[model samples]
Target: MQHFLNSSFTIPAERNEQLESLLKIHCHVFPYPAKTKFLEYGDAMDGVYYVFQGRTKHYILAEDGAEKILYCLSSGWFFGETPLTLHEPTGLISETMEPSILWKIPYSVYDKLLDVNKLFRTAIMNCMSRKMLIMRHEIENQVFNPCKQRILQLLCSTVDNASLVEGKWYNLSSHYTQYEISTIIGSARVTTSKLINELCNEGFIRILNRKLQVSKIIYEEITDQMDLL
Candidate 1:
């Protein structure tokens, strides 16, 4: 697969050096190709991955064997925090969306490092906190927002130039179909396809060569409507 997520998402400025140092401390480093299943639900991982490069998705496979994406993680992020607390493997399967660079941390080593280094502890806390906040907003977006508005918000959060675009179009770098969009929005793909088509016809958004463009006026309207959702 040719993955296209933003590859240059850098570490937060305040902690860039700290993250680099952590990478230096790590004993295992692996490069994963796009579409690789990096980690699975309930599989033990000794170290949290410090994502030096690439993108990944967090999702759960249902009992019926359907995968549902919960979040997208880009560069500068880490995975495996959830399992750290429970002393078990994560329930979410992580798949590489881009060819990725990862520095693995053994659980015991990270624990010792965190105890010896205040920065590591702070980094973990900040990362987990941000995760929680994003998840909270996701729940609200899924539960209350209309499909169009939710799509608008998702684009706003992930896409660049969201505030200035005049047309109803966007080109997401990720490869996702209407079916995946429906799964994310908890709707049928037909409903999602219809909504997208309508948005195009109504001049709210448009698809051009697989690019998504949203009118600035419509974007504002959607944002306003979002508050009411």
Candidate 2:
């Protein structure tokens, strides 16, 4: 598979706008505050969702009840297709990370669009393809890479979603706690802390006011090394 360490896998803006316009007529738009757990494991999948104005985390609970983040969705991204298409209950928990607007298109509407709208069909297929690639990359990282490398890879993968601060350092757009970072990297909190400090000392990354930032040079270096690997 192609390298995906730095891929955000977001849909292109033009196609995203087209899809949004098409769904607007049939969707129920809702405003949600940060930390809204709108969908949970085993909930009936009544519709597909599109992010109009916020970020969300999609994850599953481990046997020990720990949350393992599968991926994050930003504005323009769509989700809930798998369970909806399969006529099964939701298998992942989806929660908003910030105050946002979302569109919920009923299953009947979604099905009709898939059958009648070529653009809609193509966009959904592309979304599924990208999701599969991301999952494959995550699995390979977990099985083949060390914890520290995995952590770096995660940071690299999020660069597109981060913002540049003072025109020099890229600040992670989302505020992630050490515990959350541990869960994402599949490591213990204490171990994650130590490794984060190690990365800081080596100039790979730094934390300011509890927000992680990486310099452009360091970001490029990490991506380069990842490419070689």
Candidate 3:
């Protein structure tokens, strides 16, 4: 249900209710210690997860003081697959949002189970494809878009395609700092802050509660890019 909440399109209520029941069929539902920085990029994770309760943020850091937020996961989403299939590392910095509960399983064990139940392999392949596509989209957004526009676009996109009513506003939940945004957007802190003020003056976005709040114009600009998409 939460995954679909950030989706580009609507989903049926019944399907939302069914996610939990279906998740139990594949992974171990157990509490995991908080602050666990699990598998990283290029390394392997033995299995994927359907986070039953918890939050994790996926981010990549560059030595030059750049940080790109790749994606975030919460309950009802699955992550960590390379260890399970290719027997490789996850190769990303994954941090838990709190004391968490997750449905996890081992890939090697899954392979053994799949030797008899071939259908599981097919399911894994499909899930992997979707996750890869999402990663690609995140890279594309940061690579080409301007920081202020990109931030507005991302917030609006995550809010599920609805236009912000004129004057409607709220702060970013993550409290993502300007330094962090600069790192993620591949810009310097000064440049990012300048762009942000420009956005505010132009009536496209603003800082409220020390967080970014976008206007309908910002939303329009984002959709304009997709008009080309």
The best candidate by lDDT is: 2
State the lDDT of candidate 2 residue by residue for 1-229, as single tens digits: 0374433322222336667788898999989999899998899988998888878888889888888888878787789999899999988998987898999999999999999999888877877777887788778878998989887766766664357777767876455778877877788999999999999998888889878887778887766776677
Where does model 2 exceed 4 Å of error? 1-15, 160-168, 173-175, 227-229
Q: Which regions of candidate 3 fall more than 4 Å away from where they truly are?
A: 1-19, 29-36, 40-44, 63-65, 112-123, 160-167, 170-175, 217-229
- Single out the weakest 10-residue window by summed lDDT for candidate 1: 1-10
Model 1 vs. true fold: TM: 0.80
Write out the backbone clash pairs for model 2: none
TM-score of 3: 0.67
lDDT of 3 by residue, 1-229 (tens): 2221222111111123444544466667667676686656565565776566766666777776356656666655556765556566666787675678877766655666557654455555655665666556556655765566555554555442343444465443344567656654557789878887887888776776676766655555656665665
Sort order, lDDT high to low = 2, 1, 3
Taking all chains together, each candidate's TM-score versus the true structure is 0.80, 0.89, 0.67
Residue 170 displacement (Å), model 1:
5.8
**lDDT values, one for every candidate:** 0.66, 0.79, 0.58
User: Which scores better on TM-score, 1 or 3?
Assistant: 1
> Candidate 3 clash total?
16
